[model samples]
Target: MARAFNAKVRQREFYPGNLVLRKVLHIALDFRGKFANKYDGPFVVREVFSGEAIILSDMDGTENALPVNADALKKYYP
Candidate 1:
């Protein structure tokens, strides 16, 4: 089972200064039925931890209050 799961999992890595989008949790204020975007921000990668965790900053330069798991983010082009 572990091998099967690992076979399909692609690794995600980010480096400082790269642009990325953050996953948006579907909270009450953000719920918009089925068509809402799943992620937000073209946030800048502020810091990268050892594995599967990172810190991000808004384009305007304010850091987020919490560190996010790498899986909750994806690379952003542009």
Candidate 2:
């Protein structure tokens, strides 16, 4: 069974260079659930359009591109 992840309800201010991590709960067409997918790691913020952000994940010799919202993501730092 898939676990339910609470959506981010708070809006936060972000810039172009900000880094973020994809929430384990939020799932999109391009990327599957964080727990279901093989690539489970932090992605770098490439661009922000409106409320969606383009992120790049280089995991397991693959570059996965995903679009997510600020509220659907958490700040990621390594």
lDDT of 2 by residue, 3-68 (tens): 333353445665555556665553455443344653245655566677465545443334456566
Cα lDDT tens digits, model 1, 1-78, are 999999998877799999999888886764568888888999999898886679899999999978999988899998
RMSD of each: 1.9, 9.1
Worst 10 contiguous positions by lDDT, candidate 1: 25-34
Q: Using Cα atoms with residue i matched to residue i, what is each candidate's TM-score against the true structure? A: 0.82, 0.45
lDDT of each: 0.89, 0.56
Off by over 4 Å in 2: 1-11, 26-39, 53-66
Q: Which residue pairs in model 1 clash with each other?
A: none
